[model samples]
Target: MNSKVVEEIKIKGGRVLTLVEGDITERNVDGIVNPANSYLQHGGGVAGTIVRKGGRIIQEESDKIGFVQVGSSAITSSGILPCKAIIHTVGPRMGEGYEDEKLSKAINSCLELGLRKGFKSMSIPAISSGIFGFPKDRCAKILVNETISFLKNLENSSTGIKLVEFCILGKDTLQAFQYEFEKSKPQS
Candidate 1:
């Protein structure tokens, strides 16, 4: 409802900033991205959630990718979601230890692709931090920096994303992001 890029989707019995879950499409953004694995076939993790809520097409199109390697971003029509498009990004798994650069590239590349595909708005989950195993605090800090950097570059542009939201999954993750945004210092 608020055209605000960052919003607090309040819910009862939760931390003030904890319930930051809202429909990415309701933001009326050009797109919302999923931090998906290479398979595109939704199994569990954020991919599972997006697949369940966003629609089956999320999996269908993702499956079409065959095997998306890490650090690359891809685009697909929102077969069932309200948003105009879906950007699936393959973030590096944590076990390999390339979190920083790979995560950065994934986020940056997703935005770049969104812009290139003619999208003016986008919503994203915290990439690599959940199932991908990126440390929550560190990932939150990096994500905040990356988003602010993206906004700084898009200061006065139309194709640039006017709204860049971090659709966190739970209270702890939400708090981490809030800490990062408020103090410019991520919570450990």
Candidate 2:
């Protein structure tokens, strides 16, 4: 609960994109994106933390969904978590062919799913960057860029999402995302 707001930026349509150093399970957003395996098991890493804090109903709901393809996402109840919903996204592992594109698609899938679900705010982690072994810098860049692009495109469209947050746990990962976010700022 000691999460710090590392950075906040106003994107298109005045929507806010924030980077936070904390636990995603504790975020009080409309939705939280989980970096899940295809089976949707909340057994380890971020998934485990979510299941532990959110409760077993998350895995139960995911079991009902069965499987999600890499680069795709599925929605489920947030269980006991503060969020309204959990977006379980399957990101590609490093060394897989087309890792970059798959990671981008995974991010887009989470955002689009949240938008479709009429969520006004959502928090996401650095998908595939942990045990999946994707490079931190590349993951940060892809996630930030994709999120900014999605928000920009949503400006003219009807969407309930107004705030997107990158909730990172580790100090190094937070710094990487913060750097990417700052580098992505529009020059005046």
Candidate 3:
């Protein structure tokens, strides 16, 4: 599968946010965010792909961490994958109350985890937009907004994060993210 970078923008603090049409498991970054279940299972979707490529050690570590609350995140070794670690975040399933808030919190949780780990870069998928059933357009807006908010709020001491890529799989989703990103870009 060819990974196409649809858009890239420089945000505050010299960090770059990119929208890429690709598999998140294939990204070469300091960490990759997995749109995971609260139980941290690696059975399907992006979770399955990450486990298959990064090896069983990722699952093994997840087994130890056990359950994560919706909107919270956990970290695990990435095994043989290109990235150093995988950040697993639990997002709300549709029909659940407060889906928007939960989705925003999930994205923020991933960014907070990356910053705390002092990671230089990370890649994230559209959390909750898959089996969790979050609307793609809403997901794009929440993800991009939360990411930009996080970057803008960062202190000089938390400057390690320099790049964030939204690695989307489908064309529609990629366009959704790209459009939101473009709208959110700082006006020169």
lDDT against the true structure, per candidate, is 0.70, 0.92, 0.91
The most accurate candidate by TM-score is 2
| Residue ranges of candidate 2 with Cα displaced over 4 Å | none
lDDT of 3 by residue, 65-180 (tens): 99999999999999998899999999999998999999989999899899899999999999999988999999999999888878777635446789999999987787789889
- Candidate 2 lDDT (Cα, 0 to 1): 0.92
Candidate 2 residues 1-188, lDDT tens each?
A: 68888898898787989999999998999999999999998899999999999989998989999989999999999998999999999999989799999999999999999988999999999999999999999999999999998899888765568999999988788889989988988887
Off by over 4 Å in 3: 155-158
TM, every model: 0.80, 0.97, 0.96
Global Cα RMSD, each model: 6.8, 1.0, 1.3
Error of 3 at 139 (Å): 0.2
Better of 2 and 3 by TM-score: 2
Clashing pairs in 1: none
User: How does model 3 score by TM-score?
Assistant: 0.96
**Cα deviation in Å at residue 142, candidate 3?**
0.3
Candidate 3 yields a Cα-based lDDT of 0.91
